[model samples]
Target: MLRLGCDVRVTDTDNTDKTPDFLAGHGDQNCHIEATTIDPADNPSAEDRNLEDAVAKIKTLDSSDFQLRLIVEGRISRTLSKNELEDKFGKLLVGNDPDEVRRGIREMGDESAPYAEIRGRNWCLRGELQPISDAQKVEGGSRELLIGPMGSYSGDASREVREGVLKKAKKYDRLDAPLIVAVNVLDIRFDRETENSALFGKEQVRYSPNHPEIPAQLVRKPDGVFIQGGHKPRYTRLAGVIFFDGFVPHNPRGSVCLYVNPFGYNTALPQPLYELPHAKGVDGRLNRVEGVDVGFLLDAKSPFKNSGQP
Candidate 1:
């Protein structure tokens, strides 16, 4: 907020624990902002749990020239224990020729990649070996198998985002100023659809009332954090919600976006917030305005060059 020319101050609830995180004043536009995060750990799926366990077990194996892109499918194979996995995958890596695996992957991609599998009646764990590039390998050094961070499955991304917003909404009863909840949604599958569903409710198709000729028109269900069922404006104390994914210190370039509440009890949000990339309802239609890049707001540079590699 300091970067946005807002006079920012930490909120004190007069020794009480309940309070918004902070308050920002920008040219007579004062609003209370609460910041929160939606972490992946809080909502783990069965696939994620199994994949995490499989990776944890296999990443401990020794590998000199290869990294494993592990794939876990079906049920958590009761047939293979963690120690059994380490031993079997370890031997598989040690027995395979890294040169042959590399050549095959280069020739046929995943189809040619040498694969190792251990399967039970209902479950399977598989690993495909790829040669470790020189940049990743240390000189004359052997290391634990390098396991790439991938293959994570999404677990109700919209539900997680909704729960995060609901938790913040219920944090304080009624603040004097406009309340803006800033949610840093950290999930693999979080996107515009997830955000729209979580905050504005799910989309549905209905016939236009005024124009009966229109067969279908997209409309959102009122089952949202801001607009609940019964078609009433809920959480009116909330002026807006600011959300983004994959935000970190010194890097706000996820380009913070805002959703203004049409039925907010407080006055409109400050002009500075409008300068952000935002979505707002106008004439019952949601419109997104492209705004300044967050990098310009904070004068922060990307850690990577134009090539997108550090």
Candidate 2:
């Protein structure tokens, strides 16, 4: 809001948990803004927990010369015993030549490429050893392992967005003003489609029983965050939702967009918020309005170049 030139103040709810984060005024218009974050999928099975526990133990291995990368697949029916872990991984790491492993690491352009492999009755583990710095070797630390992206699963972004919006809507129900829920989605899969599906409903094709002559018509299911069956609006207090995909203070390059709820009880927004890129529902159709990039408002140097990472 500081970037948008709004005179913002922290909201107080008499020490109540229902308070929103901020109240801001811009050009005679004002609204309550609540910020939230949707993290990656967290529903893990018992097998998943077992695998993670084993990985944590692997990270504690005492190897100074190389950083271990573990590519895991399949189900862990039983816990991997410490002796079995050592036999499969420890012996291999101890006998491997560091120079040979470094050359193998360079030869494989793909980061997922593994230099060694081990298997159990129901699972397979691929290991990649990357040579560490001489300084790191001297100052020994736990043999931390980097997890492969393939091993991590991010669940549906639409479900995540819906749950996030609903949770916030339920929190600040008594606030009488227009409320904007700003969400920072951490999942890489979050996109325009995800946002649309979460707010409007998942698109599907259906045929009306009374109008059999009519061709199959595309329609939205009644499962959106702000919509219910028969295109009825719900969560009317939510004026809009501001979406930021993986946007953090350190990295501001992520796309910023808004979804204005057509059914909101108090849909009015401050002047600065209206200028942002937004999409609105009109007669069940979404109309997207393009606006200035957030970076244009900041007038700052490139976020990537000035990131201070060497």
The most accurate candidate by lDDT is 1
Quantify all predictions' global Cα lDDT against the true fold: 0.76, 0.75
* TM-scores of the models, in the order given: 0.70, 0.65
Model 2, span 34-103: residue lDDT tens: 8889875454446667677777666656665656667776756567766767666676667777776667
Model 1 per-residue lDDT tens digits across residues 97-211: 8778877878778688777788766556777787887776756566556555444443347777887888888878888889999998877688888888888888889886999
Score candidate 1 by TM-score against the native: 0.70
Segments of candidate 1 deviating more than 4 angstroms: 13-16, 41-46, 57-67, 71-110, 116-126, 130-146, 152-156, 203-222, 230-232, 300-310
Q: Tell me the deviation in Å of residue 8 in model 1.
A: 1.6
Scored against the true structure, residue 23 in model 2 reaches a CA lDDT of 92
Each candidate: how many clashes?
0, 0
Clashing pairs in 1: none
* Quality of model 1 by C-alpha lDDT: 0.76
